[model samples]
Target chain A: MMHSRAPVNAVIMPRMTEAVVDVRELRKTFRVSEREEGLGATLRSFVSRHRKDVNAVAGITFRIEAGEVVGFLGPNGAGKTTTLKMLSGLLHPTAGEARVLEYVPWRRENAYLKSMTLLMGNRTQLVWDIPAADSFRVLQEIYRIPEEQFRATVKELTELLELGELVHKPVRNLSLGERMKVEFAAGLIHSPRVAFLDEPTIGLDISMQSRIRRFVAEYNRRNGATILLTSHYMDDVVALCKRVIVIHRGRLLYDGPLADLAERMAPYKIITATLHDGAASSADLDAYGTVVSREEGRVTIRVDRHVAPERTARLVNDLGDRLADISVEDPPIEEVIDRVFTSEQTTVSA
Target chain B: MIRIYRALLVAQIQAASQYRVQSILWMLFAVIRPVIFLAAWVAVARSQGGQIGAYDVRDFAAYYICLSLVINLVTSWNAYEFEFEVRMGRFSPKLLRPLHPIHYSVVENVVWKLTTIIPLGIILVFLALTFDARFRTTPAHILLFVPSVVLAAALSFLSSWVLATLAFWTTRVHAITTLWDRAGFIFAGQIAPLALLPGPLQAISLALPFGYVLGVPAEILRGGVSVSTALVLMGGQVFWVVVFYVALQRVWSVGVRQYSAVGA
Candidate 1:
């Protein structure tokens, strides 16, 4: 749940002192010029620019407490990355207030900077021509990490990520997954207190993504650091975060536990049944419910959550001789999210 | 801060080493420019009865060799790097660090020049020996040249950084930097001796910081300036140092704000 802080003496008293990240009405807007696609129109635009303001992040408020791993969910162009940039001090918000560890992020005070890190997938901060270890050393110096602590952190991260010899190779020579691992190590050389990860596993293989997810979870458990992660992959969120904040078109759509979101948006279950001896075709099961798929002898159907049990019982009795096995389960998270977005579209159009 | 700088410098040098072929090619470019100028000036001196503007053929050789060294020590390509970084969205990662991004440029420039200086020095010596060029450096002149070269490098880097900040506003930064480089070369005595220029042009060179970058250092090494003149020239270099420092700060602050607003 989100809470509103009192307005009195807000400057002297930071809102949500207990929260590691406190954001209120955070907003960012860009004034982009509209230019026609022609040489003459381009020249005309130079003389008379037509600028339109696009709000990348509207007034959205949320707080993340210490040690909490919060998932930031949004589609492309939904302001997720913009919000992360603001929280990490890369971009100052056009309006609204944000405090990380009780310091205004835009101020970027040394203590604040030393206590946090931002990692963006598909972008690298490492020196591409040198080994990642060398960049790690640079970070150690820049963050003033104590030698013993730096060594220990390096060892721990290396072990966790199984980064054997990957740190020794030049970043340009490393594969995407290897590079991402090194990036994580580089960003964590100082063991920052808060990590803002934007699409950190975007291009990694499934196994590599799972490894990173496990490492993140372990890091949070061991250090109790706060984390804010944004990813298009639902598995990343489902595995690493219990709570998720869904945003669309720079607006907050929902904020709660992941399971609650699925329940609220998708009130249905999938019924997968196996035909004995492959006796029945997939078309024969359409009378039961919406047929999702029929592969081999198994058929999957979607049924209303409230009537799923009754429907399964009727199917079992009706197909007693033909059915081999049946199971009922919640719909996949992707489908739930699709429903959420579809519902939001309906509300917008309405 | 010192430790951080050392680490950054080491990393940059390692990066340069990784691209050694490119570094050597860049050094060759630097060497060729001065050699070309030396050949033209030597021809002109021989045509004019072995002397032109107080420099004989051998003296011209020495002047150009020393000019090449000074240019190598002071020149920085940070403007180009900054333009590329801004265009490619590389500045976003740099902005997240606690250290100011300018330090990265500074370290890269210093390390790159340091790594390239050995090859440049060998070329200078080869030209000096081949052309029978002589330098008139005393211990005092040498001492003055040290500070002069250091200040020139700082001025060059700061000025380049200031120009690089233009990338925050427009994509045509390359043209602006090219114009600045032309001004630097023409006025900084890369083409000819500062004293050989017309009176008004020499005055402009003396008044501007560009001449102090290469021409003054070359003059000091060539025993052209008296002790008093050397000190005055060094003072002028320090003045520009302060001016460029302030300009860098102003430009970086404004530029970063603009960059953040524009998301580049």
Candidate 2:
């Protein structure tokens, strides 16, 4: 909401034209029944149960255009999954308006369902005892995908995900990564125009995660499908999403480009300098800036971003021959996100 | 729509074939109960010196054999499956599909019957030969039996589906299902032919839907009921089908609202 990236919003925001996904003041409250842990309490619950309302989503608004891949990042239990459920027609909203492809998702009309897909990392929709190939055939019938279209999509997904013999084996027989690949393939068999992917790369090895990410990116590129992805791994969001919407405690804290978020939340840059062995003052590196680390003639400093250039110049001049190699870089996006969550003023008026 | 249903049914059949051992055990289990009842009734008839309430040993054999077949064809385990899947959170995926989740259970029920049909037929022939039971089948009765069986399947499924939706409210519906099964067993003539029951119980059986599901079809197959009686029974089956179908629709709307309010 800040002026930091306000100009970028103009290019991304869909106006009167129908956005692929539009959500406004969406809310979902769950009435969780509570019970005491004792025989007497259990008996009492049978007569009169205690219940409390927990608001999972508290009036959040966002819109996504066609072919846009937006990163939806939040801490654990921050309502990311719950919000996705509402958008995908799995859970109805307690209040607020949500439309996907101009259709109210909770109605779950066949046309709405055929046009979108939701892939939750923790849930497996494939039948465990049967081969995934058979499950794909079932999906084909469910989505009513023509035989040739289904076959072509499967072939392309198989090649992209490197799924050779994995589809033919029982899902239980496959490893976690293998099963995840099949789940991805099943979600894409219909070539849905909009996809809600929650933690799609969860539990995969690093290489497999990158492969899956690449596949998602390629799928979006080919189909111009709109996607909203949620992940705990910053690498996924950082690599795949230029724009990110961060929410905390069921509230939208920030929505802007990743670079703008890093700049706004994290005002500091990391400066690493290779110091001369003889002239290096190891014990008091903080005198120059906040000492991040000092090891093997290398001294890292955390300095204000705006003053990084001046600070580096002064350090080089003051150290003279003592500084061997010096470099300044922005803090990692993960650290910036950590700072954003810890900051007291999360809702920056933009 | 027909192609989708066919694919669903075929998938379930193939999926069931994977559990070959369980399927065989299920077939054996289905036969064991009726065979035990047949033995007990035959012993009782022998002790009674000829017949009890107009049912001789051969009559009891024919009755039990037909009861087994009717029960197998009509009964559905949708309630049990729904209970398990709801608890496991597996029902959510079914909801995401464009089709209704009940289709999965219906197809599963049909596939199970198809898989066990050969064994059920073998058991029927074995019972007829071993007990020297006169398995007479009239052309009219056979023709009537087909629709009766199909209607019975629909009635059972709709009734059980109504009970299955109870999972949306509470996890435990075993007691409900058990009471239903026992009621059907006692009143629907699965334990004994309707004619063998007391006069009052026979009237109750005729009035209730359970009798239409199992006892009526079994009677038609046994060649005892008249054509007019068969028509009345068929009418009763259709009546119950309409009643349960409406009940199922009403229950489903309320249950899905509950499920959506809570997470499925």
Candidate 3:
């Protein structure tokens, strides 16, 4: 196994080309009141309140280049949403600095706001009682989109999203997936250069999720916009993001190309072999590696990444006539991510 | 900015029109308070030999009817609504837009007032016929009343917005808004005419901004105020409008900094 740790406070300098989004040691602390679930505690809280500070975002630093799609990965309470809020100007950080499009986000200047958008899956900006097209018209006015441009954008979005009749019906009458599609179209009406998407595919069916993933990928491809996306679904990350930033409990655990995540964190490979008819029993496979599963003439083993090649070669040689088929590959991304979070000593940078 | 307001206004009107039944019901509900006050005052005037403090039955009817219309025009619920928006994290979407969130609230208020105007007019006609109300108004009073009402609405909306911005620090603003409403009821002559109050209370009513929000406009419309006095009251309305506008800006800037954007 191989591992390396960057200093927690290390600062990574940006490249020659200016980054579209840059954050340095951003932090947010919330003072939340506490009380027991009883009348006595409630009465006492009125006289003397008990409060505690929660560090929702603890000194995270990252830079995103223009036109790059980056996956922001974390478990629940991992501060992904907090960081997005700070960058989108929905929240003011307790400390540190962040610049998006060369403007301080929290200043919320019109020029800054005009250049970016934040889309939350659980929330909606469309007026509930009106058709989504009407809401889109309002967005056009708010963003100051010209009439010709607004019409062309709407046409392109409708064709891309297949929003045909959905835009004509009131938003309240639409299904969740239909509403989400409309939401995406509305959020992008201005063609924002920077987009922060928080769980944009959440709670959608598998087919809808795949559709949304494709839409996001195509949107990025066509517009060349920089996007920071947060999702619990591994499929979303695999489909769209080339690079990922992982956090745990408000601490940055990893930042690198997605291809290197498993190599750096799991440090292991999985090998599967199909034995010939009655050629060798499961017990005979012990010398090769840790047998993870053996059933129906197939045996799967976990081997350290460093020696996986040698082990596979030996197994093939020993079972020359007995081995019908064999394959070696990295472990599943979900499994690798799980290992990264569970392994207390695991942290890597690239 | 005006274009954005126009778009919001159109959208709000479309949304509000979807709930016509609810709007009419709310308008009817709003009529109850002024009607009850008018009935009580008229009864008192009758018992006091057909007059009390320069208000006969007809005069009482005119005052209450005008008060009802003025209240309807200037009423703002942003204080209560803003608290809910902040608590439930609905304000986040508004903050993301290039326009200020206050623009949405302002347009919604204006659209709501506009949508209820026909219904309010019918109700006004019914009330006048039932109470035998006689209004005394000159062209001068009528001309002055328009700006008075506009200024009153601005003052009321801005003050409520300032109170609403307090929700960033205290998520529950019901108590604060209730206190404000109580103060308006006392000092704005919503409960009784300012002339009928004690001298000390009359001075307090004149000194506070609430009288400008409700009482002055109503008085001007009923021809109870002379031209010079109407000018002075309009000046007072303008002063409060500026004060509340500045206060709203200051409070809103500080409050947005404190926003936690909870619930998502």
Candidate 4:
């Protein structure tokens, strides 16, 4: 669907005219080059270098209203992280415009900077030698957080992130997950209005991942902090974001509700049958739709939602004695995504 | 900003504390490099009957002893570290703060040098006793020395701001910083007093800001300063500050533009 701003501008009044984050037709290009090997080519390349321009992010624009939690989704090298950096004012864009809280992001004004935070996974933002709490004290000084507000935010985040005991331990001694939790707490001490998370759960165990995911969700719910979260982990996107923007090859491939994209990818059903007497030499379920997998006593196949009943009935009639059990379900989200990525110009659901 | 400076210094202390052995070893290396120079220069002076350019072996010992102490105190390698940070993408966090990253760097450099000061002072005391070094000073010069030392440190830091931003457009800033670093030693009079250099070399020394930062204040601390010499030196100090201050504006803008263009 077309992402238009005319309606968004018309509906809002003249007085309450603040968006926490906004972007339009943003682009970033890199002058990357072919790697020359050996002394000969390297010497020759210096005289007249061969260069290729990589469009890291090409004309993808979307706005996050105040307190909106939007998931940025794409495969590897899809420019989600690049886009986040541009919005956070770490990098400037080659074309188009972006604004955060009514200030130009690239200008990186102190006031605009004070109102935002950016967190990247696998990066150390805390002082590594000191106790996590002491690093927080350093942040308190840097951000000029008033004692009262600093204490309240620290206490709230510590409790929510379960950092009570971990706070006292040196950052070097803490586990990766523990350090990440403290990092988040330190980031929020200033009470920034916007937060950018780049792969926040890239290398955490299942339990730790949930702890971080829960902390992120709870923090947003309580504080109404506008968040743009980028994670390859589909679970993070599914659990936290109602709306997701997907980019492929630096282009906006999808931008809408998560459920809508999933619905569009896999609009049919897959049925798995367990048989008692079906000892066929081979399995050929393609007449119905497509066979996904087959075993000795079980076979799974996908069928159009409207034709599922007919397909199920035929399977039962053909192997009534062997039909021990049968089940029907929608395709997995991963599979739907795989199909979307594999084919283009298919009958995508609106 | 002062409050932030204090905390940044304390935080760097805590961070460096993790590598306690490395710090001690570095201190040891610091001692060896200067003492070796002191011994060699002193030997050369004594061979010439205890005199080289108005400095006897004792004077040489004292000059280098003080040089060793102050060089470590004012020199900041944070610019090279900043270059690394930009290349590795760690600069994003620094830029996200409400204050310019340079403020943090400036604070940390001051703090880091001060933290190392105690250990360095101990070495200085040992050298003074070993070499019969003299550190005579008047209260007036002592008062002036404080601001001079602070200005020297600021000048040293601001010059690096340009070096650090070189990473925005090119690789090998570490090499570039090292090249300039050696320039500081040769021209800033870190190795020899500006007066001892040949006329042309002395001209080169005075023309560059490095001498104002390291050599000039250093001479001031040695306590034979006339009022005019002190004024001229401090005036030269202010000139360097204004020069580097303007350089930072150009460097920062281009650096940020380069960063965005590359989508870093």
iRMSD values, candidates in order: 1.8, 2.0, 0.8, 2.2
Per model, state how many residue pairs clash.
0, 1, 0, 3
lDDT for each residue of candidate 2 in B1-264, tens digit (9 for 90 to 100): 787888887677778888977986887787788788888989999999969986889888887888789888988988888887877777877887899998888789888988988877987898889997755558898899999999999999999989989887776577888798889878888777888888889899878888888889988987768878998899999999999999989988777756642332
lDDT of 4 by residue, A1-350 (tens): 22322221111212336667777889888787686689999888888888989888878767777987888877787788888888888788889898888888878888888888888887877776789888888888878899999999998998899887999888889888888998888888898889999899989999999989998899899999999999978888878888777776676777667777756656789898877755372265567678777787677888887888899899878766767999987777667666665543232222
DockQ of 2: 0.54
* Candidate order, lDDT descending: 3, 1, 2, 4
Q: Go through the candidates in order and give the C-alpha RMSD of each one to the true structure.
A: 4.3, 4.0, 3.1, 4.5
Alpha carbon lDDT at B66, candidate 3: 93
Predicted candidate 1 versus true structure: per-residue lDDT over B164-243, tens digit per residue: 99888784499999999999878999888898888888899989988988898888887777878999998999999999
Q: Model 3, which residues run further than 4 Å from truth?
A: A1-14, A275-280, A295-297, A320-324, A345-350
> Candidate 1's residue-wise lDDT over A1-350, tens digit each?
12233321111223455988988888888777898899999999878999988888887788888999999987788889889888988777889999999999877788888999998887888999999999999999989999999999999999999999999999999999999999999988889999999899998999999999999999999999999999999999999998888887777777777877767778889999999857355566777789988888998999888889999999999888888899998898888878877776666666
- Assess the local accuracy of residue B249 in candidate 2 as a C-alpha lDDT between 0 and 100: 91
Against the unseen true structure, what C-alpha lDDT does each candidate score? 0.86, 0.84, 0.89, 0.78
The positional error of residue A182 in candidate 3, measured at the CA in angstroms, is 0.5
> Residue A132: error of model 1 in Å?
1.9
lDDT score, candidate 4, position A155:
88
Residue pairs whose backbone atoms clash in candidate 1: none
When 1 and 3 are scored with lDDT, the better candidate is 3
Give per-residue CA lDDT, model 3, range B108-147, as digits (tens): 8898788888889898889899989988889999999999
